[model samples]
Target: MTDFTEYAKALRARIDIALNQVIPETPNSQLAEAMRYSLASGGKRIRPLLLFAGYRATAGQQEHPALEIAACALEAIHAYSLIHDDLPAMDDDALRRGRPTCHLAFDEALAILAGDALQTLAFELLADTPGLTDSTRVQLIRSLSRAAGMRGMVVGQAIDLAAVDTELNITRLEHMHRCKTGALIDASVTMGALIGGASDQQLNILARYSRSLGLAFQVHDDILDVTADTATLGKQQGADLARNKPTYVSLLGLSSAQARAYELYQEALTALAELDGDTELLQRIAHYVIERRH
Candidate 1:
């Protein structure tokens, strides 16, 4: 079995290759340039890797070509969201992953176009994944649409925008993170499980695991935004405070947030225990996610 670190490295490489292949720079194609610019901006590819890991935990990543493509689609959708989230009308950040945000790197109009194109391209890629049967392709598209659309990531983003001026307590904060972040993270695992042909029962358990991990991931992120340095995080720390956005830290305080993250992590691992998982790898990943500086 591959060590978690090695697997993560390999997954990152694969994500980069897939992004490069799908996002092209063609002559006279403004749309293409936008796609390339946004995609090439580069982040950790965590969403795609999560999808791949879930895929592997059920059936290996190569079991279905559609799974790989669909996982990449999730990352594209994720990336597009980040691009728009950083716009002047959105988070208005100048830096992302330690580089200029898409709007900062390119003109605002082009950045908008880039984000739009990527959103559509995510679905297009899912629909046309090379090796999936027609039914599976359709299922993948439907799942992603549900997760990335209004009921999911979009709704969360809207709530986040609204909550900027308004202070949210723990309940509202959890709701926002559930929609904003957890939806896609849940989808990442769900899509992978379905594509890997997991039993319905197995999928159910995995969904529960993903749901917990997703929130934990966000809590860890919220903490890191305050504690980690800019270099490690690849973005400015305290941007949440700067924007006056309500966060776990702001709502529950750092110690409480940290405790909550740990609680969620334990719940996630406990859910995994019911399944026949390769425990060490998942455990290592669990440790890595919470402990990561970035």
Candidate 2:
């Protein structure tokens, strides 16, 4: 039983500093403020944490500059996704991380622009990452772009939007989530492994671990929608149900959804066990993903 709480806290602090350095205050105060507002709004920072864990799992020694940039870039992408996801055209969320949503805190147009800026900034960070070989940088950029672009998160969002009020089977729902949330997560692990110079076999094993963990992450989220309160969840409780969204809980019932989360948790751990290096952190993250309240 590794204490992942302390590991997460330490890595999160490092990631926070990196993010602040990468997204410094600029001349354009409003856009900067909106960008900082959403980026700084505290969430789990799970993606970056997973990235670091992947690095560790590959026997990465020091905190490479490229690894830091990759972690920050992933967080930037995730923050941008949240900004757009909360827009009026999307989930129309009024709350995020226990505070007003970006669109409500700032204006809608600004929020949209802020998301756009963050998305571009993410790429810029990847492109300008220092000390990495050009090939490594290209691989990181390509993986991240695919994860964030039409083939990944965007298509997932499109599927989710279209599936609203429409019946979706468990397989279709899983596929949607794999594209939507899982792609980015898989990229995080892959990017970290690439930075650490993981072998192809190690990368494949990590991919399996990340994929299972990603779905478990979403499954737990669905469970929390029905189980946790607004303040506890840092957003509206039952918002998914209110929107008639197809969640694991909605499709499989709460008990079944919980069971499925545990199943995925085991699957992730199993994959991680196949990898060489200190994988305790990744294993603990799998546990955290399934057991998290929000």
Best by TM-score: 2
Query: Which regions of candidate 1 deviate over 4 angstroms?
Result: 24-27, 60-62, 277-281
For residues 235-285, what per-residue lDDT tens digits would candidate 2 score against the true structure? 999998999999998899999999999999999988987887888878888
- Give per-model TM-scores: 0.94, 0.97
Error of 2 at 100 (Å): 0.6
Runs off by more than 4 Å, candidate 2:
none
Candidate 2 local accuracy as lDDT?
Answer: 0.90
Model 1, span 1-294: residue lDDT tens: 677778877878877778878874556487676677678666666777666667767775355677668866887898889889999998899888888888877778888888888888899888777866788778778878888889889999999999987978788888888889999988887787777777878788888888888899999999999999888888888999898899999889999999999999998889888876444545566677788889
Model 2 earns a TM-score of 0.97
lDDT of 1 at 90: 86
Native-to-model Cα distance after best TM-score fit, residue 151 in candidate 2, in Å: 1.4
